[model samples]
Target: MSSCAKADASSSPALEKAALLGREFSLAWLRAAGVSDPEVAVLFDQVILIPAAQHASARFADPSLPRKIVRTIPWSRARDHHLVLAEAAKQQRLAAEVVAEHFEAAHRFDLARAQWMKAGETSCHAGDYKKALRLISRALAIWPWDEAADDRARVLREMARCATNARLTDEARKAWEELADHARDTGKHDLRADALHQLAILSADPVRAGELLAEASKLATRELGPEEAFRHGLAHVDLLVNRVRVAAAKLAFVAVEEAALKSKNPALQSEMLGWKALIAAMAGEAGDATRFVEEGMQIAITHQLPEQVAFAYKRRANIADYAGQYSLEKHSHNVAIRYCRESQTGEEIVCMGCLSYACFRTGDWKEALDTAREVLGQPDLHPGLRAIAGGVRGMIAAFRGEKASAFRHLDEAIRLQRAEGMVGMEFLTLWALAYWHDCQGEGAKACAIYDEIRTLWRESDDLHDSIPGLLFAGAHYADHGRAVQLADCIDIIGEILRKNDLPEARATLLALGAEQARLEGDHEACDKALREAAALQIKAGLPLEQLWIESRHPRAEDHKGVIALATKLGTKPLLARLKGEDCGDSASGLTPRQCEVLSFLATGLTSKEIGDRMGLSTRTVEMHVSRIFERLNCRTRPEAVALAQARGWIKLP
Candidate 1:
């Protein structure tokens, strides 16, 4: 409250007449700016004064000088008019009172409004949003006699626009709330619903946001129709769908879809289908996801909205993210970016988040850093987004060997995620932090973090992401002491893997089982598990896993050929412990399968024929032969056969 604005009570009475003259001039000026007498008369009606016919005609012909006002006229609208004139006087560097009188008598109100609004717009364009906001407020408060007294919602909405440009979210939210109240009081359901929709988006609390959106939907349906109802509820449905509240999202989606179908709105229908695909993709229902995504895109092509096209592309990106195809994900995000608007901050931030994750996975560190920093740079970002950005920075920091920076970023992510009740992200951040701790050699700390999430992992929720995280934790848990924990890990994860037919998890489980058996001194069991896991990994055709499994078993790395191959593959960290190791078969207790493979190899059977005979893939057969060579400390099949015969480990026919 500026002192100048607060001291309105003690102004001299003569200032009042200046205001009266200003209002009469404003209405006359409005007529000259394309407003007709009928429009003015109908809107103003009886209570408010209209310019007298003869005087209005006279003023139109030849405007009187502002010196005509010498008597006081007492009215708030009049005082407000004078205030506007005083500012206008200062614009021309004239005496305030003299210009105020001239403004009331001869100056054009239309041009004054245009000039003030243009000044505010220029300030906004220059990024001086605070000054723009203040200037815009000053413009809006400049009262004229022909005011739209019943249309305060529009006024409040304009004020909210100013606050938004200034990045004053709290002010904008309050303005929208007030606007909603005003519209409701005036029985304007459409305006009220729109205001509520804006308020829902501005709210930080998810529960509050959902409530506000729901209210808007209900109000629209009750006062308008199903079409408007869905329009108001669309954002809420998207929010729930993306956040993984499956049941709630499905309910809202169903309602919106039904409304879209009933109203025959292709654009809304297309958007609804896009959301369906996104939800299905998040749930890992790839067939359903793909079908819905295609249907949505075809419909979007027929629609006028660029946003719907962007929605369809974003769903495709989500599917790619789930499939671990980072390149495809990036491509989809780029396409989506083209259709997004400058005002679409939330949508832009989400695409950036996904792009950052894809870049991180594909080892494009520079882009990852750029995208994460871009999200963090957004004005008035949500806490969950903050946590997401911090977590990404942590991973990049760790990769760059900045240990302290990594811990700082990850710790903040974990803390904010937990505080915001972002349960899924909290779990993942904790999982990532544990891996970072292990990488920094804080093994016990890593194990403790695993202890925190092990039970949650067992719940079979979000398994696509949680399974890998838990697998990492399970491996670290084994390092702390696995004899007791191995059975539990195997039992829980094995059942889930089998149910889902997840071969990768199954292979990794087998590898962990091998380590567990070795820890328990069951060398035979250990060798059997390793052999099966290696065969599976080879069938899966993942070179990284093959090298990783070899790293775990030093005997498997004994072959100079494999070491050279691993070196070529840039697997130095996994192969680091392989150097200066014993090349004896002391730990690998060969089983009957290995013996059978040895006999097959001795008979000069190729990998394909060996696989045909043994009911395995050629790659699996190759893996078995490689294991045989490793266990026998040989570099070739013939060498392995000769070593086995010399040791009398196998009998030849």
Candidate 2:
């Protein structure tokens, strides 16, 4: 056995038995410590029993021990029944008030009031709101005039905050209003401002909320503290963002950033950086957004603010998504979710939605669908989230060939987004619906919606997604006789890619250029585009694009090359088809005669000169030229040449 076990065994039975006898244990303890009987009675009454009653729960599981000892008390403090009242207070505070009332009936006002206040504070701390409110109100009825007035104010503030935490909003508001009046009457501007701030957070009307914040901010000047000034500045910025006062918001945010930076407060700086990141994201300034988010993340980590770290991660994820860095987007989302607050369900749901979209971009359809459904199943989900979830579901449905279901869900999403006044979500829903329609071969109908989407993009200046928009427009616009407009859109896409230095987007753009070349019957330009795009995709480990370029290889001479690429890419069925005895899957949508004209055009040969070589009339050659233009959906020679090259019909020198 251990030392404790040995000590227990060797200890005297009589000495141990003293602990079981209530009054004997107390008297023995007093005698052993050399206290006189009269002094023992008085000390037990005033010093020992009162504190023992307060601390009994911490010291023993059996309340009977303390209660039994209390019954044997032969003395009292200011009153005789003090231990009885303490015993009652320990059992149930409200029942103890009867003991206090009895003391009150004997006119011992101080002792009675102390018991009532103790019961109230204890109940309040323990979160028994109803009992706390009742007891605290009763305690307040007998105010101590000799005590400082500040004590009363402090108690009233506690009552107010307790009601607030308990979600009795109206009661909290009333209490705060009373406190505000008292503070104003007493010339306490700080307390008045605090009351107004609480009222602002709870106000239902945006106008009233703004008014309250304004009132509070005027009262809480820079003299308060850097932390308070930072909070007020952020609130002012929020009001500006809500009212769409972008310039004013930016101007207000600068002041906050300067304050935090100068104050050397990492926590405050992190918060300001997060706000800056949000503004940059809204404006489609991806690089700026990324820089701000990263700075915030570093600050949050250095300062050990876990929640701020989470917000920083979320901001980076949003910027990565806007920049089309899908892998980075997913990673940032995971990190954000790892550190997010348990009660911040809405933020978690937003992270989930971002992760799902990231999966979709990286070609993980199954995980994307599952995550999207998880977003939909969240309780108390915002309608803005429903709009986003519906977009994901609609895209998945379209990919699986359920066009009607795709349209139904997307239309409903658009409706909800409009109802919620979520302009950003509304724009995305409309874009998704239009893209789906075009994917279903209704390019004409899709073009009608694209006009609005184009306008939205222009107004929002979100040019990062403009590449996909360019591709969609090229497919639909050329046939609709908007060839000049289509060319201009592609030019803009090229400029954006160059300015942004996005090499990943460059491959997709070059692939699109190949499509335009193929349309212009420039087979060589088309072959050049295919080779460059395939090479870029290969370097990026983008197997899907390499497989696509192999399947659509533009020349007979490039057949073995396509087969070799497929083999290198580990693409089984595609390689098998390319190497098969009957390689009929290599068929182009263009006819043999059109291919011949396209090849001649790629050689810089005029149609009339080609007629002399083929022994056909110039008029017949002109007829073929018109027919080729119609077939390839190109208006100009350059466009026809570019589209044909993208389709892989022409061989490059």
Candidate 1 Cα misplacement greater than 4 A, ranges: 1-126, 132-151, 218-228, 301-313, 323-356, 359-393, 396-429, 443-461, 482-501, 507-653
lDDT of each: 0.62, 0.61
Model 1 lDDT tens row, 362-457: 556578789999999998787778887888788666534456788899899877765554555666677667766655445567667776776655
Give per-residue lDDT, candidate 2, residue 548. 55
Q: Candidate 2: where are CA atoms >4 Å away?
A: 1-252, 255-266, 278-291, 341-346, 416-428, 479-481, 534-653
**Could you say which candidate leads in lDDT?**
1
lDDT of 2 by residue, 1-653 (tens): 43223323432222122222232233333233233456444433332322244322112223344454433334342133433333333344335465456455435666666666677777787878767766666655676634545666676677677676666778678777877877778878778878887777666564576677766665655446666767776776666554434455677677677667776888888978988987676555777888888899898988888878888888788777656576888899888877774435447777887687677556566777798899999976776678777776775564344567878878888777554434455555665676566444354567777676665555443445444445455545543446565666567667657555454457667766765675576768967977887787666444444555554554445667666655544444345334432211122334456566666777777878888787878788777778667655557776676655543445445
For each candidate, what TM-score against the reference? 0.59, 0.50
Q: How does residue 608 of candidate 2 score in lDDT? A: 87
